[model samples]
Target: MKIRVNNDASYIRVFNATANSDKIDVYINDVLVFSDVRYREFVPYTPTFPGDYTVKVYECGNSEKLILEQELTIAGGNVGTLVITGIMPKLMLLAVFEDPNEKTCESNAKFRIAHLSPTTEPIDLTVNGVKMIDEIPFGKRTNYAEVPIGVYDFTIEESNVESEERNDGIRISKKIELKDNKIYTIYLIGDVPDIEIIQSLDIITYMNK
Candidate 1:
């Protein structure tokens, strides 16, 4: 859908996190905005005038069967993500927002985590042995935290699990590099015992248009 550029514009993107859903299409205010989005896929940020909007989701090529309908508000000059989550027959939408204008230290990178896995338990995120976020539940996200630029091991484990039992509780462990002055979000998606992560570099400049 074409939206007129204006000073009060807001930017939004869609992520398909539904583990058991078919490829889908998304409509905002009855206008087709994202189409044929498959599982684990993301639609790039699109601009829209800030206001209340009615969002509808339907299986791709079959709009007659509505999957979900929701109402959401978009504030001016902000960036956000709309995540389609949960398994079939019990789906939902999650809205996560970020302020591009939020100030941060230039020498460090800003990082956050989003828990989108429908079947996973609450999690704790540790980077290089330091706990960055503790006990974050599903369908929630953490506020940005500043970290010194460097490569580090990122680990996600079940919250409240003992270190000795980590072998069974650990969900993901991987190395990721943080670049100076960059903004990032690590999203934990999919169902438990089969969870996956998607790291995103948030570019604030792109939201201005």
Candidate 2:
């Protein structure tokens, strides 16, 4: 799958969410950027100049077999993530970006959900029993929402399920703490009945400067 963005000076990284893929290498404009990236792993953000470029992914050590090729544009002073998702023979690239204009204060945090589970039903995310994100389907990502910095219970439930029938439809339940001025992505990965929740910090490099 290919993705095109408007050009800028950006910080980008790669996440391997392909449940059935082997270790891979990622190249930006033919230059190796991430190598030996295993499933469920993340390659940290790297700086890039503002421009358009090609992104190619290959099975580790096999340049002759191209797995996927995509087009990316670096947005100046922003941060983004390029995700490799889905099973082989039907792989895709998903671009998730942080809004550079949404400023955060020291008393609050920001978070969003990324649904990467290839076979799971559309779902809802509840934080401490309050619905925060709703009806997010496979391969869809939600925009960041601000919340007070604190510990909370996060639950993932199949969307549209009756409240009384939620026991069996619940997919993930976990507790997480959010810190002041931080950003997070809650990733729902793996296949149904065997799902996993991965919480990762999203650092906006341009803001750190």
lDDT of 1: 0.83
Candidate 1 lDDT, 1-209, residue by residue in tens: 22233459777899899988889999989988889999999899887688898999999988797999999888786577899998887889998877666445666787889999978889999889888789999889999888788898999888967888877774798788888777787899887678887888775523332
Kindly report which residue stretches of model 1 are placed more than 4 angstroms away from their true locations once superposed.
Answer: 1-7, 205-209
For model 2, how does the per-residue alpha-carbon lDDT over 1-209 read when each residue is reduced to its tens digit?
Answer: 21222345566889998888899999889998889999889988776777788999999999998999988776576577889988786788888887655556778888889999887889999999898888999988898888899999999988978888877785689998988888788899876677888889886512632
Question: What TM-score against the true fold does each predicted structure earn?
Answer: 0.89, 0.87
Worst 10 residues of 1 by lDDT: 200-209
The TM-score between candidate 1 and the true structure equals 0.89
User: Model 2 segments beyond 4 Å from truth?
Assistant: 1-8, 167-170, 205-209
lDDT value, residue 40 of candidate 2: 89
**Shift of residue 121 alpha carbon in model 1, Å:** 1.2
Root-mean-square deviation (CA) per prediction: 3.4, 4.7
